[model samples]
Target: MECVGVRFAHSPKIYDYRFGSQAPPVGSWVVVKTPRGLELAKVRTEPRLGQAVGEIVRVATPADLDQHSKLKNRAEEVYWWLKARLRREGVRAKLLGCEFTLDGNHISVQYSAEQRIDLRRWVSELNRLAGARVEFVALGPRDQTAYLGTLGACGMESCCSNWLQDFTQVSIKMARDQQLPLSPEKISGPCGRLLCCLQYEHQQYQELLAELPRKNSKACSLQGVCGKVAKLNPLAGTVDLVTEEGSTVTVHKSELRWE
Candidate 1:
């Protein structure tokens, strides 16, 4: 049950593989047999006790690395060629990237389109031209954005393209619980989805909110003054109370008791 996590090129997701006879170090490259074909992947985590989906073929040799580099260049060429061909044929698709298996027996072409495209003819032509199997992969908005990386609203690289290995469920409720503005422009990432970071500190925010008085609830301050809870500052651990004297005052949560 010993397994290690491996990541493929141009993707952040990691796959667990069992190293049958090889002990590939972290950050090293290894050849693994995927469902599609034999692929070169980087070791992202050290070997640990876990379930593995696939088995590593072997540690990648220097020749394997060289071959991978050449295939990468060739994939770039094929991608451009396919892009131009698609444009000329008026095909409504955006080519994201192209990759070849380490053994050069298969080619994976990533693309995004509004609808399914019947590219049987193109696939055949590419197969004959490259002398390898060609397959098109349809990508969703999030995967498309991950393939073609861009800066995020935080002026840094998007998390999906950076170090995030898997996409998690992110909801507007997380933003609301964190007291963030509900504006889509402010909360959505380049993928036109809720920002992934919104879920990072959500649990902590929820815990803090549980200890604070709900808005519009009756509460008494430490000085024996009573007021209605107006607003909450979860981060600051303070609440804005509108006093019965018609004044808004900020008081720490510890200084207030809910009625």
Candidate 2:
């Protein structure tokens, strides 16, 4: 079946929809019947490879865009309304935002919390105010950051919010392999997990590290000075060696020997 990539907002997620008859051009707005409801989404790409469980209703027109904008604005209002209501009810949760269906028939709210929140009343109140079905989507701290978005420690946009479609497991081993500061504050990102960028050059680091001796292992320089492998700089292709007298010297890995 022919597939298309449709996305409702600036979110990184794109949904695949089967459009057997309505193959619209990329960047065109189209109404799609998602499991949530009728969603007004933009055609990001054609021939998208995925399970197309949903079907395209029709190509959205100017009036549809106007209506979508108005409903989106109302959805934003509902987000704040829910926030205030939660605060008044003393519910512990952080509201990320709301995604409203194209026809304003349903709304899915993304939020984060430490524990389960009784949002049945909140959902009812929102449905009453919105005149639409309201859903609360529970998210992890990382997924919350991905949806709400924030600048990363690298002075750039968060990867997950921008281009990272899926998250990979990150661990302290990646940090140690990269020889970065082991401090949580230094290694952790806004998601309170290891920075996603740590995995960027990790494979290269692993390959380079394999070619060099491990730290604290026995190694000697070309000058016959041998002690322990103090530090390894893969980028510079040099290894810092500590002599028997506790003196240290930096030498290229090619000139070092473990024998």
| Runs in model 1 lying further than 4 Å from the true structure | 224-227, 243-246
Best by lDDT: 1
lDDT of 1 by residue, 96-121 (tens): 98899988989989999989887677
Task: Quantify all predictions' global Cα lDDT against the true fold.
Answer: 0.89, 0.84
Query: In model 2, where do residues sit more than 4 Å from their true spots?
Result: 48-50
- RMSD to the native, candidate 1? 2.2
List the pairs of residues colliding in candidate 1.
none
My TM-score estimates for the predictions, one after another, are: 0.89, 0.92
Candidate 1 TM-score to native: 0.89
lDDT for residue 34 in candidate 1, whole number 0-100: 89
Deviation (Å) of 29 in candidate 2: 1.8
| CA error at residue 48 for candidate 1, angstroms | 1.5
Candidate 1 has an lDDT of 0.89
